[model samples]
Target: MMTEQDTEILIVGGGVGGVSAALAALERGRRVVLTEETDWLGGQLTTQLVPSDEHIRVETTGRNASYARFRDLLRSHYRAFYPLTDEAAADPHLNPGAGWVSPVCVEPRVILSVIDGLLRPFVSAGQLTILLETRPVAVATSWDRIDAVTFETADGAEIVVSASVVLDATELGDLLELGGVEHVTGRESREQTGEPSAADTADLLDMQGVTWCFAIDHRDGEDHTIDRPARYEHFRDWRPSQLHGERILGFERAPEHAGDPARAYLLTPNPDDDPFGIDVDHRNMGGAPELWTYRRILARRQFQPGFFASDVTIVNWPMNDYIGGPLFGTPDAAEHRAAAKELSESLLYWLQTEAPRPDGGAGWPGLRLRPDIAGTADGFAKVPYYRESRRILAERTIVEQDFSVEILGDNAAVSYPDSVGVGHYFWIDRHPSTGGHPGGGGRPQPFEIPLGALIPRRVDNLLAAAKNIGTTQITNGSYRLQPVEWSVGEAAGAIASFAVAGATTPRAVRNDERLLAAFQEDLVAHGAQLRWDSALRW
Candidate 1:
């Protein structure tokens, strides 16, 4: 069957950025059509099985107000519905998982429910339409403007959507390739980008690794081991040069301590330490030398005594990072994705059979997979956790020097006259790549998202909404975080709505001072912070 639809704004990915863009557009009274390849939205936070990775100042400052509200809603949902202890429910800063990664590290399913609730009003009012299990297959373009996009549904139905503005929010930037929007993949050479962290030569296939995350809970004296995967041996003994010949399935791994050699990590579940003893704002408390609590999604201590048997944690460690091939722009994309899943499964098997214990023993056979938490038949997340995307070449490509603290000094970043929003990260964190580029971890200063970065150099009616915005491989490391992505999507959505109302192009909005100021004021009115406060600097 074939169908056609028209809208004011078309968002082609339902990750954090896509949802934010949809809300922003719908609030501005523009009809929106949002599509997602997976059944669930909230890509990294839900389907990808990763919690919100945020900066220390995210709670009070250095973040978009809308993003902050999303966090508050997640916490409020737990307090309102879940069986939290009075102490846990009353704490203003509730760390559900008490995980080191983010303060709001709850299960992926909770995020899906909260996001659906947030979009429910617009959806019922008919101002927003959401299509799940749909992906873009082709793009209609003429004279540097996207005319329409054809999407293939899960059941083989075709739906062609035409919109005045198209936002590319796919995790891998699928539209950039299908629509022929000029984009750059992998690391740019030092000579090209002038980045101190850039490689001497460019390798298009050197993109960061992707992980297939899963959740597990431990039960003592019970065997819940899964059947061994078919390719278990391949991953058990397999290792790339990035790990210095150490098996990736083992506890000792490289990049454990930044600027140091490989170190051993332990697997201790449900330690006796009180989860409430730690302060929410302290980052160091979660950095304990144990694997189980690193990304814990459910801390049993947060509930009443005997309410839960065990804590649930997500397995997204380096052991499962698949760097054998890139997911986009490759013939072996399916093979690579399958291999990544196998790697994660093999890691689980190893943990259940051979992982080291504190009492000088082998295996914890009690580790069980929680498919319900992931909302999938299998325990693995519905989609791989992607770290890099096909970034568009835009009017202004943010570079490493623009925010690297080592180069710009502490509390300093390049000033942008057309700043749309701000984002901050502790470091430029990059995972290993297929092209043998060991991941980088350089400290970074708080940065701004330039309006020019959202506008494609030549595409008239398209915008980069997610990790696909204009940034070099080096700078993408920090800009790709959750809040930053939300900020970018919000800015893109606001720009599209403004362009439609003013009957002007995004380029004209940037080129004309009067239009740019008015557009920025509109963004401010929607609770977006255009710049960071002086007190936020380190």
Candidate 2:
């Protein structure tokens, strides 16, 4: 028997920075509610499916105009409902899964149908409410604000809400450990963030390692193998001494730059050999080494050749990366998220039985498992893609020399006069950890986002939109992707609608420089770029 409500902005993780902080606090009229532990709302692009990794001049410059209108409403929902192929319909940047790891690689139910058509006009003018599957589980607070939270729904009940401005936007910032705030979980040392690639000590269980992504297609003579994983021979004879031991369900890994070495990829899936440029660039990681068109989302030569015949792909490579632990606050966090969904069902039963093939055989029983492109019946991805969170304790934390291209070699990143947004990556990708810590990628230099890293050194109104800001676990691996969590959730919903229309406080609009230049001029009159233009670098 628990109910209660009230809102001015509550947010709590609807993901992709709580739907860009409830579309920047319902286009600044406020009164939002948000919530969502996934019934789908584009968190990591629809229930953690992961695609929009951006930057390399995202179409033409550093992003955020509401994340370029969510990549222009996902290429206007595949040009207003797919069928393409007139040269992929007059190519104006249509990469609808011509995927070499994202240039708008479509489908996670078309990013939950462009985030339900951009929040169905603030949930039909009731000024947004959302809820979906819920999950917050108690907060209340007082001495430092955050007066109520509670949640817990997907059937169980209990509601509670109450808000003045409390973003957190979950995905592991679970209301900064249920509102006691002052965060910072897993990995912090090189003497606590002097970060020469950290970890000379502090290891709150290291972190980064959460995969569980899925979605496949294939179909040659059809077999669809599945149902083998009950710890399929313990992840098929697992091997990870930080990968030198290899056998990460085969297909071999370790070599997207950080001190390179371990190799062996090539999955092919559609290759008729050479000349297949789909235009990649996740700093060359997806510059195609061919793991089935590396995250290909649809591309049947961009539709219309007999209306498609299997080209969908998405396995989030590094052979189903589940560095064996950490999915939550640990106590073996539900057996490490059920052994990372049994190592993504034993890497789809070792790619449907022993991989290898080239005219030489092994498996692929015509691959399968689409579950309507992972809206999930059991095909995975309804969550589990995180690359680290629970960060705050902020008042500006972001280290790794504030944007290391080997310690700002050419100089950029670290501007912040309370900056507010802009993000880039090409390094500091970090992924192998569960305390084993082999993660690597390291290049970095394009960053920005600092509104004192989304406040919170003492909570006040609690912001930190996603990947729980105020970085460092080596800058939360480049501010944890998807267009920097949609510009750190449209700058925490335009700083909770300019601190609830100026009763004022997000650390008094970031220590008042005349309320931080009128909230960065209302976040650049609602387009929110904040900085990063000086002839854009990589």
Candidate 3:
């Protein structure tokens, strides 16, 4: 049996984007329902076990208030629970002087608690309904509008949700696929978008590889040898020297502007712990065992005790990431997933058996996979960190021209008149491919989130609220960060509110200056920075 529920706005995907949208809509006094495929609410922050990875300037530069609220909630949670010195709370960024990004280094559990606390109010208010373990399987649409969405739960129960505005914030843009919306999957052709680095043709699923991250704790003088995976012998001999003989961790020359790669390493006693960073010359192997060993350098005795402790988190472990080209085009997606899992298992086995010990010993066979730590039955992350999604073909697709270093200029960046949000990250942490662009790497310039990107060319009642908006293959690298995802989500919520209140479509809100202004004003009131500035401005 199926039942239908109606709301003013329905947000699919209970990740940072979906939660942000739900909060925004609720604040606007609109009826909203947020659904998640998993039991947890916070997507990447909670289930994924990915410690926050925001640009340095997020606190000051990001234009999304919900993101800021998230940060505040994190700080408040830490204050209430952790036994931290007052200094830690006062200096939230961890780095005393670095205002670039607030590096509130925290544990995954703490973040999950905070996210749950933030959503409690809305749950109680009835304005927001959170349906967890619910997967949206279908979308019902008229000629130009979305009428309702149908979701299926783990128990085979189906529920139909109706809303005036549908926000596709799903990690993989699942709704966009179910709704029959036209979208690009893998990578776009170079000729199609004129992106210097675009692929030869448009492969909608030609997305950046997804990582299955996990945490590890190292205890001194313990033997932890996980069974060698079926593919262990292959990877053992197939060392990509770029990552040293260890098969995972390696270093490379920093950009010429940053300084000589050797010089970059000069300031460090332990190359890993040296605050002076190493330019990942080439991270081709997707943080395999070699890469995992490299990260182990950071867990020096000085930074924190337990260099020989019972448990420590080794985050950059080898895990699942679609390896050969785009995952969507792979002949056997399930086979690829199985192979990836084998690769991860192999890395783990290597770490437990062959990895060098602090005392020059061999292996830690006792290393156990902690699903409880990663919030999954498999020790890997709860969800693959999806780097791309079903982007709507919008009236103005945000291309590299809008964010390119050549176009935006050095020291001076462009700000869109219809800016909805802001985000800034390295131009592109491109995954190494056989035919991808080479030597075109450099620092990414600041970028803007225009209202135009949110407006679909033909869709009437839906707006993208995550990485699935209207970015070219090139620009997604920058806009796919956590803060930016929240920004897009916040903007979508505001737009949904406007659409419901004014009885108009997203295109109308974007095309009309008056309506856009009102929406922007509301965003500002909610703590978003709409305008740009020389410092912390994108």
What is the C-alpha RMSD, rounded to one decimal, of candidate 3?
5.1
List lDDT for all candidates, in order: 0.89, 0.81, 0.65
Candidate 1 local lDDT, 149-268, one digit each (tens)? 999999999999999999999999999999999999998999999988788999888889999999999998999999999999889999888777778888876555658755778778
Worst 10 residues of 3 by lDDT: 262-271
Stretches of candidate 3 exceeding 4 Å from the true structure = 85-90, 95-102, 199-201, 237-311, 317-321, 325-331, 356-361, 364-368, 406-408, 433-441, 535-538
When 1 and 2 are scored with TM-score, the better candidate is: 1
Judging by TM-score against the true structure, name the best candidate. Answer: 1
TM-score of candidate 2 on Cα atoms, chains taken together: 0.34
Instruction: Find the 10 residues in a row with the least total lDDT in model 1.
Output: 279-288
Q: Which residue pairs clash within candidate 2?
A: 42-46
Question: Which is better, 1 or 2, measured by lDDT?
Answer: 1
Clashes of each: 0, 1, 28
Name model 1 segments beyond 4 Å from true.
254-262, 278-288
lDDT tens digits, residue span 1-538, model 2: 6788998888888888888878887887888888887688778776877777776677776777777777877887888788987776777878877776667788888778778888898788898889898898889898889888999898898999988888888888988887778887889888777877787898777787889888887888889898787778878788977776777888766574667665777886765422136656665564227788777778787767767787888888887889877878878789888888788888888888888887689988888888788888977788788888788888988888877878777887678888878888777788888888778747777878888888888878889888888888877887898888888888888888888898888888788788988898988888788888765556
Q: Which prediction has more favorable TM-score, 1 or 3?
A: 1
Output the lDDT of residue 60, model 2: 71
